[model samples]
Target chain A: MTQPRWLDQTEMAAWRAFLTTSHLLERRIEEQLKATAGLTHPQYEILVRLAAAPGRRLRMTELAEGVVASKSALTYQVGRLEEAGLVERTTCPDDDRGVLAVLTPAGAELLEKVAPGHLEIVREYLIDRLSREELRAMTSAMRKTEAALRSG
Target chain B: MTQPRWLDQTEMAAWRAFLTTSHLLERRIEEQLKATAGLTHPQYEILVRLAAAPGRRLRMTELAEGVVASKSALTYQVGRLEEAGLVERTTCPDDDRGVLAVLTPAGAELLEKVAPGHLEIVREYLIDRLSREELRAMTSAMRKTEAALRSG
Candidate 1:
């Protein structure tokens, strides 16, 4: 195989910093959510996605895709959510094997209760940390990265 | 309680965009690593941390802390790595309950082989996507966020 063009020293530093930051930030957010809302970040993400989707529900496959998780992982997570009464799973009318996850009133209420704290953490850790210019730069950079990865 | 300050439209947009971009970027990196090196991002992170450590080994607790994973999760991951001949576990002489994870020569070789492609993907998705100013801004913002979370 040909030698791959690797990141230079500066680029390597930035990449490592970015990875470390991303991991730590995620852990902080998840820890806060677990303590305050009794929900994992992934669980909260699922609820938020369902709430945003039409009819406040999505098919299992669609939910998996939205969350970028495997079907089995989604199933296990949704099962836990269902047991907690935060979400409901229903058989899809069009396909028996298909299941739709719906955010229940209880789930919506839980999210509503947690939104303030979650938003506050987000503000403190992410939004407030960045200046206007930094925010714009970050968004632009992320978009470029996303586009490149999509093409690659 | 006082009315909690929620993210304004602009901040909300940035937050959501950041989340989406981060998730997609992780997925892209994981896919590339899986295809090229047969290693998940978390596994690669573990290997990298061990490789960077003195003697290319660390206690289970230390490894977990370094990787920001729970003990059980780290145990499971190390088990997988051991099965793959990438790592070995040995009882610590000083601490009976403590175990050391030592990187195998095969593991070090694999890391050396995969580092170039992995760094390239990271550069493509993160470092190269930002300008010098933007990179500085991101690093600064991340540092602030990390400090805030650590202090809080």
Candidate 2:
């Protein structure tokens, strides 16, 4: 048997902190989004991603990739959004088989209304907690980790 | 309505990277743990938490808190673990009303087998992806964020 290589104190601390922070932050975000915006975190992410897209629309595949969600999950959320008149799935102008998710006027308005509370919560729990250098380092670390995850 | 406090470009970049990286990393970890250990990430977490506790036992509440899982979720996962003979929920020796999760011999054995693969995956996907200084900064950022989340 190959000997198991263990994480030393530094590595272990980093991993534990990352794991704990991520779990707590995600739960807190979900709770606030649910209570304040009547949306789950994934649903909010879908809205944000669509809102940022050109013409406030994205191909289904592109939105799924942008949100880092599974196709089926994105479809489910989009369906719920459609029911709420927040988004409409339309036939893709660029591809016969593809569909697009476009933010509806109501959805954009809702997003606008929800933005203040959501940003406040995010700022309180995350952005405001970090020093300027820490924020930059976090951004860099995330990018590096994401690149490695993608390549590996 | 209060004006939305928008994230400036730097804040936006940091938030987006954090959101994207966390989502992708979680899915990847769950997928790998499922494939390599026949365990969900939470299940693996439960095992590790139990194994680290003194006498490899912890009360249901403490286990839930330690794993940051909800009571109902922990109960469901514990039931599965019990069925697999990986863990045993026994009446606490010191408190008749308290239930404890104890790592079974089988669970310890399985953890030993799964440790190397899991560690390698963690290193490849996360720990090794960062420079030492980046890891330290990440640790600090996570700690600060987690403390903020807890207090607020």
Candidate 3:
């Protein structure tokens, strides 16, 4: 029943900025991906992770963790990808109950086709707007925040 | 069709950090809000916005813009809030076709009850982790990005 600590001016400014920036960035990314590739941001992340995996494949659970998505959500997206012939699910070699999401040639090709436009939106809206020093500071701060959230 | 400019190492690192931080932060906020108040983040945002507006009410379109939510999404969340007795929908006095979302006393009470816990998560996971200088950089960088996205 202690008094709650409120955010000071600087903290409030930073918090508001983070909220606004994140919302706008996600919306823009979603719009770009949907228009160009008919994929959601999470779906695009799935494909990118799979494309970079050792054999263009990853276990569903591992992919879910990497993408910060739930297992069920990942399964649903993988199903969509399968229907589109972009990805396939296979039995995991290491565990009977486990399944792997393998990026198909079509998925790879789509990613390759979609990546430049994706990066352009990202760079135009966010990365290119900040100075090197600002980028470094943001990276450092965000890394700290990410680590704390993961551990907590 | 010129070769798309790719991210250099620093840019890539910054971009990844932003993505991971945003995802984790959003997940944490969503989990905390749902657990504490049975509210999703967007629903909570709507309540907060209504609580701050003059007369504790705002036009639906204005609320949507303030929260960076789509009109349909805002309408859906407002509908849920109305059902929960936290908000009410009324015709805007100034405009016949416009609807206003007004926060009830119960809604304000719920926000008062919830704000402390929400701020705690934001502070613990994000604000307290950064130095003042880092926060300034983040705020400035994010502001620039927000402006660009809003204007573009």
Candidate 2 lDDT by residue in tens digits, B83-138: 99999989988999899999999999999888788888788878887888889988
lDDT of 3 by residue, B26-110 (tens): 9999999999999999999898889889999999999998899999999888999999999999999889999999999999999
Off by over 4 Å in 1: A59-62, A89-100, A150-152, B89-99
Candidate 1 per-residue lDDT, tens place, A3-62, comes to 787767766666666666677788888989999988999899899899899999999989
Tell me the deviation in Å of residue B66 in model 2: 1.3
- Please identify model 2 stretches exceeding 4 Å from their true place: A1-3, B1-3
Go through the candidates in order and give the C-alpha RMSD of each one to the true structure: 3.0, 1.5, 1.1
> Between candidates 1 and 3, which one is better according to TM-score?
3
- Which ranges in model 3 have alpha carbons more than 4 Å from their true place? none
- Which consecutive 10 residues in model 2 chain A have the weakest lDDT in total? A143-152
Model 1: residue A107 alpha-carbon error in angstroms = 2.6
Please provide, for model 2 over A3-110, each residue's C-alpha lDDT reduced to its tens digit, 9 standing for 90 to 100: 778999999989888887888888988898999879999899889888988899999998998899899998899999999999998898778899989999999999
Q: Give per-residue lDDT, candidate 1, residue A74.
A: 92
**Which ten residues in a row are the worst by lDDT in model 3 chain B?**
B1-10
DockQ, computed on Cα atoms, for candidate 1: 0.58
DockQ, structure candidate 3: 0.87
Candidate-wise lDDT, in order: 0.85, 0.89, 0.93
Candidate 3 has an lDDT of 0.93
True contacts kept of 2: 0.82
